[model samples]
Structure formats: C-alpha cells, structure tokens
Target: MKPTQRLISTLAVVATLGVGLTACGPEDDPYGDGAGSGSGGSSASAQPSKKPAPSDKATDRADGPGDCGTPPKLPAGHKMVEPAVPPSKGSLSAKDAKPVCTPNDWIYHGQGKAKYYLFAQDVKAELSTGPGRTKSVPVGQLWVHAGDCMTNPGAVKAPYTCSGNIYDITLDSEGQINSIKEIWHP
Candidate 1:
C-alpha cells in the first residue's frame, strides 16, 4: 500500500484504542463483584474475624452505667413474676372498675388545649412533657380511648391487633399530650 495510506491506517487503529481506554476509569471493574475485588465473588463468604469475650478485668472496668450496661438485677427480696396480659381488647373506661397502675414512666396527651395523663403496667411511668426534652410527668389517671387496637411491640405504628395490650398514643409536636386509646387482644 502507499506509505501515506499505511501511516493513516496505523494512526486510526491507535486512536480507537486510546479512546476505548480513556472511557474506562478505576471505577470500571469489568470482572469485580461490585466491591472492586475483581474476583467475581464476595468477601462476605469468608469467615468473620473472631473476637475474644470480655475478660473479668475488662467487665469490671466497663465505663457505661446500669449494671455494666446490663439489665437491672431484681432486689433480693423481690419475686420474679410474669408480665400480665390484658383480659381483652378495646378501651378501658372508668366504668370498667379501677385499673391497676404500676408506677413507672408516663406519657402525656393533649386535645387542642386540654391535657390528659395515662398510666400503664409496662410503659415507662415518666416521659417528656414537651418536644425534644423529656420532663418527668406523672400518671394521674387514664381511660383508654375508644377505637384503639392492641398490638405487639415493634409492630405497626398505630391501629393494630395482637395478643397484648397496646395503645394508640398520640403526642403533640412538642411532645405534649394528645390522646390515647388502649388496644388489647380480645
């Protein structure tokens, strides 16, 4: 072929290769498992590094509070009793006779302007009365609001049913009291 034609052909091939390579970056892992390993496999399949249990000295020197960040030990004289389950689902009214109130943390509710108090067996007896900060509020008395459904913990956000007593509790924007409806399993 002519010299000029041959030179032009060679330049064309080189230009194509240069453009191809330029389009690829370090992020382009053609054979990688998306982890940049380029091995077409996952590192998660490998056994995790084993960790040693806390030593006695390490446990004692633990810095956090609450029995070394453990559950509180019951008093020696205190007896372990199973948590109680409500007899039924639906609002518990004052006409249902006196409901048991075990002192603990409490959450308050308000409707437009008026406020109300709620008491429960398991829920903390005291909760913040206003937004962001939780002030110590008392559980004066409570009458389960109608239409609330009992639900299991960590389930639906509101209006559900389960074999336990759950409440459709509402709080204001500032964490003020709103309304509460006791939901219990039938």
Candidate 2:
C-alpha cells in the first residue's frame, strides 16, 4: 500500500477509537454493583446487577418529592407523569400511586436489552438531558426549552459520572428508567 494510504488509514482508526472512548470519559467512574456512592465504575454492561438490600437509606426516597400527597407543580405545565408503581426489577421499586420517582445517586447503565437500568450510583449514568455548562442561572428548576429533554447538571457537564449528584428517576412498568431529573441541593 502507498505511504499516503497507510497514513490515512491510521488516522481513520485513531479517530474512530477516540470517539468511542470519549463517550465514556476516562476519568468518569462508570461501573458499580448497586451499592455505595461512586464505589466502582466502567463502561456500560449487558448483564443485570445483583440486587442490593431493600434498606438502603440513599434510595429510601425512591419516589420523587410530593409523591405521597401533593405532586409538585412542574413548570411549563409539566406535571409528574409516569406509570403506576410496578414491582421492582432489582431492589428498587416504584411503589406509588402517581409516577415512580426513585431518588438516589443512580448510575445510568446505558441502554441494553431494551431496558435502561438505574442501579445505586454504579451502572452507567445516562441523563435524558443533553450536555450543558455550569452556571447558577435559576433555582433548582432546570431551564429547558420546548422540544428539549433537559440540560446537563449545573455543576457537572457529563451525566455518566454519577457520583455525588442526586436524581429523581422515573421508572416504567417494567422497572426501567424512563426519564431522569437531577436535583440541585446545597
């Protein structure tokens, strides 16, 4: 093969690898067994995680705020929407009358087996919201325009890092994460 051809081929391979690796940042902890905060991390996995105990305090408030009695009034006429509580796939269950909001530091296990896994801050954390910069623009509310899913966390840019950020996850009937909203706290 010509030298130019070989050089171009090498560049193409490097570019491809760069993109794949950049998706999940090297510094980003991406693997965990549904337990402690930022315990372990790696790339997205295909298998299900071993169920943890049902008494995890971090995941105690599996449902979102105002779940039991009054639901929080979502701005832009967005009300808390989700399916009725279904039997949990793992230790987490959506046991509520309204939508299922799992409040914990769940790592978003990337899409797999046609299901999105939200383990205890250890699967692969995928924010329905796209990327954004960090700046105190408004209150806890995430400023999202119409036809937009959501913006990245105020402090952190990447969503898969999943370490200290707390989130309210909406699970479907089959116990799969549908949408995720990161809660800002002081």
Candidate 3:
C-alpha cells in the first residue's frame, strides 16, 4: 500500500477506536459495579458519605449527668444559693455534650441555678453576673473564673484575674447546661 494511504487508514482506525471507547457506559465498563449507571465508574464511589449530625442522640451514651462524679465542695462560708436558672442535668459526659453556636444560650437556658456561686471573705458573688472577663473555654467545656466574671455590663476587656472558684461547665444539643464541675477555688 502507498505510505500516505496506509497512514490515512491507520488514522481512521484510531479515530473509530477512540469514539468506541468513549461511547462505553457504566454497564459496558468491566470495572464498574453498575450501581451508578450514568455516573462515571469511579466518581460515584468517590462521593463522600453523609456525616451524622452532631446532635443525634443515637451517637451519645444513654446515661445523663447523674453519671458524672460528685461536684466540688462549696467553699467555707459559701452557701449554695439558687441560680436564677438551674442546669437541666447535674452532669454530662464529654460525649453527650454537643458543640453549640452560642455558648451563652446554653448557659442561660437550663433549669439549674443560672449562675455559679463564689464566696470572698463573708460576701457571696454571682459567677454569671459578677464582674470579670469572659473567654472561650476548650471544646466540650466552658469555664468562668471568679476573676473572669464580668463586673461591668459592656464589652469584656482584659486585666482579668482569678477570683473565686473556677466554674467548668458543659452543654447539650438543646443549649442546656448538662454538667457543672468546679476546677479551682480560693
């Protein structure tokens, strides 16, 4: 055959093979399981699986805050005054506490005392409403030191000092304070 004719034939054959391969569907693909008929063979498998919601109860333990250890003893001369709102549960496990968008919402929503109590000299101070700076605690936990409590009503600024006891708290999905544990106290 002439060289030009041979080259033309080869080119035609390659084009036909390319089109044939391109036409193959998932059903025709030997590597595919056929579950995603129209989608590319591996693309269907590459899609990410749906992640479970953070608030799903099934992911957490059945027990509530009753399972947490005993809370720290109230400071001497410090009385356990009733909080404006009490926490929903006495305690909660780290797994049960859900990440919340607004930590204050969780802090103010529960049935338990709305604020933590601290005693200085003979006087008692409210942890929530008291004067101090407020900052983000670690994940799964919220903290408010007696010094961290705000005395002023406006924006929280620096010069924070550790005052009374440190109130470490946690919350559930519904923004309820599920657990309260005191870390440090005078």
lDDT per model, in order?
Answer: 0.28, 0.32, 0.30
What is the Å distance of residue 11 in model 2 from its true position? 83
* Candidate 3 per-residue C-alpha lDDT over 1-186 given as tens digits, one digit per residue, 9 for 90 to 100: 699999999999999999898855532434433233221111001111222132432231122311111112333332222123222223222221221112011111122323433222221112322233243333122222321232321323333333323344433444444334332221
Task: Give the per-residue lDDT digits (tens) of candidate 2, residues 71-176.
Answer: 1233342212221222133332222213222222222221212222433422222232322313222211222310122233344443333222333455555555
Local accuracy of candidate 1 as per-residue lDDT tens digits, 32-124: 212321211111011112211233323422422111111122223321111122222322222111111111111111112222232344332
Please report the TM-score between candidate 3 and the true structure: 0.19
* Higher-scoring candidate on lDDT, 1 or 2: 2
User: Evaluated with lDDT, which candidate comes out highest?
Assistant: 2
Q: List the candidate 3 regions with Cα displacement exceeding 4 Å.
A: 25-186
Sort the predicted structures by lDDT, highest score first.
Answer: 2, 3, 1
